[model samples]
Target chain A: MLSPGATIGVLGAGQLARMLALAAARLGFKTHVFAPSADEPAFDVCAARTIAAYDDPDALDAFARAVDVVTYEFENVPAATAEFLDARRPVRPNPRALALTQDRLVEKEFVQGLGVETAPFADVPDAGALARAVAKLGRPSILKTRRLGYDGKGQVAIRGGGDLGALFRALGGAPCILEGFIDFVKEVSVVAARGVDGEFHAYDISENQHENHILAETRAPAAILPETAVRAKEIARRIAEAEDYVGVLAVELFLVKSGRSERLIVNEIAPRVHNSGHWTLDGALTSQFEQHVRAIAGWPLGSTARLGRVTMRNLIGDDAERWPEIAAEDGACLHLYGKREIRAGRKMGHVTRIELE
Target chain B: MLSPGATIGVLGAGQLARMLALAAARLGFKTHVFAPSADEPAFDVCAARTIAAYDDPDALDAFARAVDVVTYEFENVPAATAEFLDARRPVRPNPRALALTQDRLVEKEFVQGLGVETAPFADVPDAGALARAVAKLGRPSILKTRRLGYDGKGQVAIRGGGDLGALFRALGGAPCILEGFIDFVKEVSVVAARGVDGEFHAYDISENQHENHILAETRAPAAILPETAVRAKEIARRIAEAEDYVGVLAVELFLVKSGRSERLIVNEIAPRVHNSGHWTLDGALTSQFEQHVRAIAGWPLGSTARLGRVTMRNLIGDDAERWPEIAAEDGACLHLYGKREIRAGRKMGHVTRIELE
Candidate 1:
């Protein structure tokens, strides 16, 4: 078992890593953040930090020697980098999980193979393949890159008679997945954690709303049937148990209304803490970041009890400038990523409110 | 009003400061920790930090110029130090509050003058005064220095028929307070905060236990009569309004039960967050540290709702070695002060557990 004062090394020094470092400190563990960019956000809150390329062997070696276990904030950790650190120290959520999540096609197949419902999807490698996949999936489909896509980036929409060949080239002709759009009433997610000892814990379901494919707001106890919520959690539990997941895993689902019946179709899996789970930091007994730290440290899972009726709103870019008004609001919990600039589409911070029933 | 990106300057870099920095971050405010120690716990988790002696004028001036307001983790801030920073920027809880709290004699008189019940106390400057005070107060009393006393330090107990002159001379001939001991059943505290606009909020009373004169454990919703609890909160409110305090304040009280009747006597007052209030970090709707940050930053006070029956235990010195075991507890929340030594009597960390009724 990991003891207090032991260091946990984190790859990717962003806001997620910054929060993870803070959580680790609360549990009596220190954090060492490693990122390629020197101006990474997580550096400000870590006991130690290294600004060097992921391929820099010397820096990686030093980091490996310092921490008891290594974890990543983002799933895009290079396989070689994971292997390098895995050879020197233990890596939680393992490199295989990273490989499975880094590729969109593999992630879709993996979810479907687990007997979990996923939207109709087909792999498209070329213009011919795109046309054939579109024909199979029908119109109003989303074509997303197979790798390294986030925040509505590297995605194209094929509405009815849109050109297939130009669309393929527009996406750089990379391996992609064509997903049949679900006419869903809302989007929901289950943020859960699995420990090394096979223990499972899930927070309450959150109903999410998006603007331009980026999360806008998340409210807890998703407006859905209790059975549907149970199924959502079951899907996440099966996936984590199947993979022997040792950290927080978030499963995003599309809630489809079908003639007085409701069904949840898996949209994607985030093998780390997700944006939808940010509300738990102030609204639940155990926060997702702290849960992740507990899992990797091989500790007991915390209570996932929702404290009250909770809602979280993302403060994107310039939206965070309204902090003064929000701070003046009664019982509003505001959080900000300590990034220096206000770039468009960047997640600046969030505010959570818990109403007593 | 302070904006989202405003920086807060905090003096005294301990676990309290670390928690304050984290709380400020949640409100989209940055914390700049200034302390004389190079390896303070707060340094690892703040947006910025400065290392310099409290008496260094240049460092103080630079620190004051960089932040919107100044606050401290402890009440030992010297009058000159607070004045230097106050000249350059706004200092919350003001220097007068600090000066009042740093001296036990002043604090007792201040509380008593407000029509609040306090242990009978008399100032003793020399052997003659000591003899006279002892003759009036009688045996079974406590002799404490007038200034710089905390956690059982700088004080000695005078049993029945003890030497008054020798004890007085041993106290360095400094001004002292000889307080008649009260027959109390339990010790409790009310941790509250006052916003800059004069709004006040208080957490529920916490029953405190001491080991070797150092705090060992605190349980919230202290076992006391309903009226006694109400009086405890009322006393705190009156004190806050009287001082115009704009930060967290802890009022320690003695619960006297001499039959069916129970009464509360004010024992002491802390101008900052108290150890007895640490359970709020994981057990209340708003932590005392976060509440202090909000109040000093001129934000609305959060609800002081306790999550459950909570117990907080301090890990002093070698007791911190049990962190591994503590982490393995299903519902225990652990916090470590990043001090590098295991010296006896040092507070290393604490663990809080919230039990649902």
Candidate 2:
């Protein structure tokens, strides 16, 4: 087990890394954030920061030698970077998790292999194969890049009367997956952690809302059936066990309810802290950030007890300009990412309101 | 009012400043820590740090220019240093608070002037005055240095038939004050904040216990009568108003219960965050450190609502080595200062346990 003073090296220095560094500091672990950007948000609060490309061998070697373990804020960490760090020091959640989640087709196949229900998916290697997959899956499905997709990027809807060839060319002829859409009543996620000792703990399910394919809000307890919540957590646990994951991860699921029957379809798995889990910062006994640190450090997992009915809203772009009003609101906890420029669709900060019952 | 991204300059880089900087980061303010030690705890988690003597004019000028406001972690900030920073930028709780609390005689006199009860005190500038004060206050009184006394340092007890001359010489013939000792049933403190807009808020009273004259533990709500708690808060409010203080301050009081009636004596006032308020970090809706940052930033004061029954124990010296066991505890929140060496009685970290009702 890593001692209290051991340093954890974090890849990607965005808001996720910033919050992770803050949580690590609270747990007495120093954080060294390694990012390509000199003005990344996490640098303000970390013990050390290395500004270099992910594939920079010298920088990666020095960062690996300086930290006891390595973790990343984003799932799309370069395969080579993860392998390099893993050889020098333990890279938590493992490179296997990165390889699995980075590709859409691979992630869906892995979830299906675990006996978890996922949307109908078929890999399209080229435009001809895309036409075959489109014939098989039908219009209204989603054509998403197999790799390097985030925040609704690198994906397009296959609506009726659209040219499949044009759409395929628009995605730059990249390998893609056509997923048959599910009419989900709500989108819920299970944010959970698994320790090296094989201990598992999951927070209460969070119901999420997306605006323009960017997460806008999340409410904990999810307003779902207790059994559905249990099943969702079980799916997360199974995924963590199968991956031998050793940090906080989130499993997004589509909840479809009709005529007193409920079904869950596995949507995606985030191998790092999810924006939906942000509500746990104010509403749970132990936050997911702190839980990830604890898991990576080989410490015992903390209680995932929910403290209240909580809602977290992402302050995108100009939404953060109202921080003064939010901070003045009773029971509202405001967190601002130290980003100087505010552009539309950029996540500037977040605010969480918790109502104790 | 200072905006979210404004910088907060903190004096002293011990655990208090470390925590203050952490809180400032949470509120979206960057912190620049100024201290004489290169290895101070706050250096690990600040945006900028200047390692120089308090009176270094060039460093102080640069630090003042870099930050929007200045605050300190300790009360003994040299009056000259406070004055220098105050001239360049606003210093919260104001320099008058530093001058008042740094001297025991002045603090007691000021409290008394506000019609608040304090232990009867008399200034003893010399041996003859010490004898006269002892005669007036009687035996078993305490003679403490007028300036720079902390953690039971620079003080002696005047008992029945002891050498007053020796005790006087032991204190290096410094300016002292003789205070009549009160036979109190308990020691309690009110940790409170006054915003720049003159708004006052106080956390629930905390009952404290000392070991070797250093704070050992603190429990919130203090197991005191409701009226006593109200009166204690009122005293704190009065003191803050009298001093025109801004930022969090702590008022330590002696509670003496006689039959159905209770009396409170102002013992001392801490111009910065107090050890007694550490429980608020996990047990209150808003932590003392965060509250101090809000006050100093000219922002709205956060709620002081207690979340649960809370107990905080200081991990002194070797006590922090049991961090592994502490981290494994079900509901304990552990915080360790990044101090390299641990000496006996030196605070290394703290653990807080909250029992929800």
Give the number of the best model, judged by DockQ: 2
Per-model DockQ: 0.53, 0.74
True contacts kept of 2: 0.56
Error of 2 at A248 (Å): 0.4
Give per-residue CA lDDT, model 1, range B29-137, as digits (tens): 7889999988778887787889999999999999998999999989888889999998889898888888888888899989988999999999887778888888889
**Best lDDT among the predictions, by candidate number:** 2
lDDT of 2 by residue, A20-128 (tens): 9888988888999999989878999999999999999999999999999999999989999999999999999899998999999999999999999999999988988
The list of candidate 1 runs beyond 4 A from truth reads A257-261, B169-173, B257-262
Error of 1 at B143 (Å): 0.2
Model 1 lDDT per residue over A1-357, tens place: 787678999999988998898888887678999999977668767888888889999999999999999999998889899999999998988888888889889988998899888899999987899989988989999999999999899999999776799998899989898999899999999999999899999999999999988999999989899999999999999989888889999999999998877898998889898899999998887899999999998888887888788999999989877777776676777788777789888998898998754
TM-score of each: 0.95, 0.99
Quote the chain B TM-score of every prediction: 0.97, 0.99
Q: Which stretch of 10 consecutive residues in model 1 chain B shows the poorest summed lDDT?
A: B323-332
